[model samples]
Target chain A: MNLGILIAGLLTLAIYSFLYKDNPVYRAAESLLIGLSIGYTLVLFWQSTLFDKLFYPLLREHGIWLTIPLILGLMMFSRLTRKWSWLSRIPIALMIGAGAGAAIPAMLYARTLKQVSATVHPLIMENGGFDISAVVVVIGVLTTLAYFYFTREHKGVMGKMARVGTYFLMIFFGATFGYTVMSRLSTLIGRIDFLLGDFLHLLK
Target chain B: MNSNKTRWIIYSTLLIVVVLSYLLGINLITHPSPEVQKSYTFIENLPESSVVMVSFDHEASSLPEIQPISLILLRHLFRRNLRVVGLSLFAEGTAIGYRTLTKVAQEYGKQYGHDYVFLGFKPQHISAILGMGESIRGVFPEDYFGNKIEEIPLMRKIRNYDDILVVISIADGDRTMQWIEYAGAKYHQRIMAGLTAAMITTYDPYLASGQLSSAVGGLKGAAEYENLYGRRGMGNRGMVAQTAAHIFIIVLIVIGNILYFKNRSKGGGNR
Candidate 1:
């Protein structure tokens, strides 16, 4: 008899009760889930980041290099006061600047350059066979780009290309929508299995 | 019937069908996708004792889909005698990654520090990813259990991405994309992903570009890997109920379209 399984099963029922109609029990469970998640995250960050990274190095190891980050971190608390609220922006600016600096080039390379390289494949395979899928992808890419082109009025050939682009977009959205349904159903199936197999012992 | 009552009927019927399907134990036969096979094959052919980094790049909500995928990946890595450096970009994944790693390791009689080490969660994920391209121990100075990174035998050997063979991200969201951008693109480290079904399409561009070496996606991905691994697990167990629910939803959709057209024809404005 696992107390954990029992408690989890009841909470699961509480959550699913909303489908029947919302009630006090469902709200309580929802609140509990959110509160516990935040509490758990706070404890985790306190231990992993604040204590381990900041206080430990500052106090025990006598590491002086970490002081810069420590001060920046402490300065963030200025946001609590009306007068010093502007002071908090210094740290935020630094964080944003650093993050963007490190991320932008990498993002551009991966999201754009590599994608373009992949798109520019020869219409013929190395084996000298025609690449039908390559042709479809090329058309898909051109048409999709045409849909997003705002400078040109969508008339004549542009209109047709944009219309084709819409079909590709719909195909993507449909595939994504189907997968989303499957993913949600997977979660549902998991909870049902837990309730029946673990808590009720109804399944072997 | 009132709309509310009809809604209730649909819900009740779906639930009853799922329960019945569960009792009847109707499972769909699952096969590994080409992407899953590619990931498996890549991991299988790695030289013995190569180091691999696996990031539990998901929150706790998606654990049902993710757990089986993570379990199977770790199982295969352990079997291949690869040293795994486990960590999580998501805070919830710290305990989750450690728990999964320990479970799989125990099954293979593997030691914690010798066979694997969980480097724990790192805040500021992109920074952590880039920093790990330089130094893993620098990024995560301590393990999940608060042991110094220097103390772990596995951590001592794996200084950065260069020392690691590949990075596997078990993700339910865009963290895998960040990995592809920062870790794989910037450092040229190989990447594979285990994703929720919904995220499969999101990563298609990356997969097509070979930015992701391969991806195993969702509960079906789990079932497929289980089949490949020659062991049935939760992924298989959930399939019957999923199939039952899917059929019910389809039936509802069909009935909905019928009622919609009929109402429109009668000038009831799609009642």
Candidate 2:
């Protein structure tokens, strides 16, 4: 057999071995994935951020102004040291604060306003007469939302409503499960296609 | 009449239905050919050269499902000579999307910047999203390759949301909703989503109510997109395997059920 086939077979074996039971081959592949990811991220981050934003300005313009970010970046490395670890918080805090500040208002509008408004759309049709589908969708949205409406006891009439909501929730979950199954099956198919169609060229 | 027999019957019934459905292509409703209908509607509705933001919001993990849709859509956009601005919501998707976009753009002889641009992954998702609307250049000062955004031909004329016609998010998260509120509602930019099959139903209301122009959900949707573009990619390849796998699972369920019911009839223990 050719080297190419050998390598491919080994990789397939390594990946599929996880099904039978976890072993050293799986561990090796998993570790390699982590290592490769970190390495790739470092390269990308350096290319996109550090080299572009940091070194390019300094090198192209000979600007001493680049010292600020350079210093801040160096400070980030200080987290590795036992004594200077506390200094890492400045940049970490800034990143977190900025992330939270950005997420809050955007989430407020997107999750609260747009999602709620989208849920509350006209259930009955206007020009096309009545749309049962639209009414069903609206009810589905409300009931599914109600399924998660905790902080109140779901007892008696409220309990019945919650149970009704739970039914809607189950339908939603069934739909989700169906889609997820398709997606996962697709992934397996893609891999098999690579092995069968692309590589082996079998059964054509 | 026994509890065990009833459970076995339910399991076997479900198995038979699922297998029959897949093998026969039996669907309850003939889903409107999403491939043709959605793409045609999208192309005809949006004016030529309109700046459309396409987010590669999925990862390599989901490439099996998402990449085919990404390629066909890119082909459509490029074929129509649309000014495509690509970004990634998930970091893992950055390289995958960039590679796919570059390959498709090259196929159509689309020049970078003049026809399409990869903005890469915006660091802060929501802020960067809002910032894109507020000031396109300020949020992404440079292109993925580190070229200044102001100098890039694709971005030069874009001052803000006025130039942005559509924001297409293909994500696994609720970030699509973020785009709707921040860009769609805030700037009235037409939004579309190409999402995993699993996330489709939650956003169906958006598609119906005119909040989103259109969307393609999961591998089947991706396959539909591929069919429209006149190219069969991994999505179509995957369908064969998916149908086969579903059949396998259904068979397993049926066999398991048969074993259960037969054992139960013999007064065998549940264990």
Evaluated with DockQ, which candidate comes out highest?
Answer: 1
lDDT of 2 by residue, B185-251 (tens): 6678888887877677777767755677788777777776666666766666556546656676678
Model 2: runs farther than 4 Å from truth? A1-13, A58-93, A122-124, A127-131, A134-153, B1-36, B172-178, B205-210, B254-271
Q: Considering every candidate listed, which one attains the maximal TM-score?
A: 1
Q: lDDT of each prediction vs. the true structure?
A: 0.89, 0.73
Give residue B193's lDDT in candidate 1 (0 to 100).
Answer: 96
Clashing pairs for model 1 are none
Worst lDDT run of 10 residues, candidate 2 chain A, spans A195-204
What's the lDDT of the predicted structure labeled candidate 1?
0.89
Model 2 C-alpha lDDT per residue in residues A1-204, reported as the tens digit of each score: 567666765676587677556799988877876787778777776776677667987989787888976877788998899999988888788778977876677557755676677656565677857877667767776666666789778778667777878898788788888777776766655555556544565624
lDDT of candidate 1 over B86-142, digit per residue (tens): 989898887888889999999999999999988888888988999998988888888
